[model samples]
Target: MPVAIRLADWDTDRDAIRSIREAVFVQEQQVPVDLEWDDQEETSQHFLAYRETTPVATGRLTQGGKIGRMAVQKSSRGCGIGARLLQAICERAKEQNFQQVHLHAQQHAEGFYLQAGFEVEGDVFYEAGIPHIKMVRSLI
Candidate 1:
């Protein structure tokens, strides 16, 4: 599959990012509105992945490289979209001089996060009614 990652300021990527987030988090996972939508959005860099000009995945990176709102369209889950989006996120963080990147890993996704070089450093907790754990990766 062909995919390209673009880096843009908040204005350029907001809609695409929100669409994917709503598709995956809201429609698919049922993450509550209060949690799925957050105040941090304005301060994040949204990365939208398009396959042949169609948005297939999206994610966001915060100032300190906190990655969240990572999502792959339902039909695209097993096609490496998430991994590629994550790779883009990490590369963006490195380019921005971030020393570390962190994520709230839904417990079931620990293995996926692990494959991306994230390590769990804390107990599992609840977030938006889903069990999650704090995972971090260092680039420095």
Candidate 2:
């Protein structure tokens, strides 16, 4: 199914964004609740992907040009929802004049970011008890 992706307003879309992140990160991945949320919500540009009317995926681009908090519902994986979301986020970054965008991807998902034109930048590190690697994609 084709998913609809759009830039989300944090105040209006907070519930849907929180639901998807809590489901994928806190529940499934066992990431601590404290680590899953941050003050960035108010400042970052958020992206949400929906299947019809149901929210299926989410991601965000921060004011500092960092991409993070990406999550796709378990039932919606491999459906290209993530790629579309990333594209939308990247386009937004370019529109905002960001030189490059970077993300700390979960190790297993490194290949996903790689396929989206991101290159691994450093050694593995732990975040929220999960191994992750830094990846960057130039918007120039």
Candidate 3:
């Protein structure tokens, strides 16, 4: 199925965004709720991927050029929805005149971002009990 990607409004799309994140990060991954929700949502540029009418994945690009909170439902993994979401976020960063964009990718998913042109920048560290590494991609 073709996934549709779009810029999401935090006000109207918060529920959909939270559902995906909660399912993946909270329930499945055991990330603390406090660590999952942050003050950045209103200021960040959010992207949502939908398979037909149902949202399957989501991510956000902060005003500071950091991409985070990426989540794709387990049933939807390996279908390329995540890459599509990342591309949309990167394009949005370019539109906002950001020279580069970075993300804290979970260690296991580093290869996914690497294939998308992001470079591993530092040693792996733990966030919310999961290993993560900083990765950056230049857009200029």
Candidate 4:
């Protein structure tokens, strides 16, 4: 399947991106509802990956250079959709002149970001009942 990824607007792509995040983070990973969704959505730049118009992956970059809410559908796991979403957000951050992009990566998914040039920065911490580690990648 040909994958398409693009910057998403909260007004237009909110439902599509929310669906993907809900499935991966809420239903699958058991992330708490309150923690999974936040007010930051309004201010952050989001990216969505689609397979022929069906959203499969998503990520968001905030004004403070924080990348978060990265999720990929179970069916789309192992494909490059997650990477594509990450790259889209990273490129956007770079274009916006961010010096570094950082994220609290789920411990299991840390390797995925590591492969994309993100380095683990600190000891593991818990977020939304899941173990996470802070990771950072320089856009400079």
How badly does each model clash, as a count of residue pairs?
Answer: 0, 0, 0, 0
- In candidate 3, what residue range of length 10 has the lowest lDDT sum? 79-88
Per-residue accuracy of model 3 over 1-140 as CA lDDT, tens digit each: 98999999999999999999999999999999999999998999888999999999999999899999999999999988999899999998998899999999999999999999999998999999899999999999
Clashing pairs in 3: none
Error of 4 at 54 (Å): 0.9
lDDT of each: 0.86, 0.94, 0.95, 0.91
Error of 4 at 127 (Å): 0.3
- Pick the lDDT winner: 3
lDDT of 2 by residue, 1-140 (tens): 76889889999999999999999999999999998999999999999999999999999999999999999999999878888889899999999999999999999999899999999999999999899999999998
For candidate 1, list the clashing residue pairs, or say none.
none
- Give the Å error, residue 127, model 3: 0.7
Question: Which rank order by lDDT, best down to worst?
Answer: 3, 2, 4, 1
- 66-105: candidate 1 lDDT, tens digit per residue: 9988888998888888998899999889988999999998
Off by over 4 Å in 2: none
Return the lDDT, model 2, position 48. 92
lDDT of the structure predicted as candidate 3: 0.95
> How do the predictions measure up, each by TM-score?
0.94, 0.98, 0.98, 0.97
**Overall local distance difference test of candidate 4:** 0.91
- Tell me the TM-score of model 4: 0.97
- By lDDT, the better pick of 3 and 4 is 3
Q: Give the TM-score of candidate 2.
A: 0.98
